[model samples]
Target: MSPTTKNAGGDRAGGLRGELTPRRITALAAAVIALVFVFENTKEVEIRLLIPEVTMPLWLALLAVGVVGVLCGVLLVRRRG
Candidate 1:
């Protein structure tokens, strides 16, 4: 098949089809790095939001921020696409 041709599964027959793209691999790697960073830091840290301060484990704070980041990314993608 030609490089530009598509298969029935809607994938490029001679290109990356049902395969992990560079973007996907990069995302996976970033996720792994983030997880490792989160898990490595277990110390209690004080977080300040606006005028309020709260103390929690660093891992929990990191996880929460990660979740919020993921949610924001999802929302933006959904709105645009």
Candidate 2:
């Protein structure tokens, strides 16, 4: 191999900038879709918490649930790995 083509410190030529694999692309797409789904729901919704009911924007509720789901996934992965 030519010296000009050799990577510095044995790192890839483009480093992480060239590492956008199919899995990263799919994850980006999923995040965009999830954001759209959450924002599209702008109507007010009533949520029942055992004995009390509360009203809030649907988007807020959806976003909160999404955050919780992501947190749970992260926790599970950390626990197992």
Q: Which candidate's lDDT is highest?
A: 1
lDDT of 2 by residue, 8-78 (tens): 55655455666789988998999999999999999999998799999999999999999999999888878
**Which pairs of residues collide in model 1?**
none
RMSD list, candidates in order: 5.6, 4.7
**Where does the lowest 10-residue lDDT sum fall in candidate 1?**
9-18
Candidate 2 has its poorest 10 consecutive residues by lDDT at 6-15
Tens digit per residue, CA lDDT, model 1, 1-81: 788776575745556556798998999999999999999999999999889999999999999999999999988888541
Model 1 segments more than 4 A misplaced: 1-17, 79-81
Which candidate wins on TM-score?
Answer: 2
Candidate 2: segments with Cα more than 4 A from true spot: 1-17, 79-81
Q: What is the TM-score of each candidate against the true structure?
A: 0.69, 0.74
Query: Local error of candidate 1 at 10, Å?
Result: 2.7
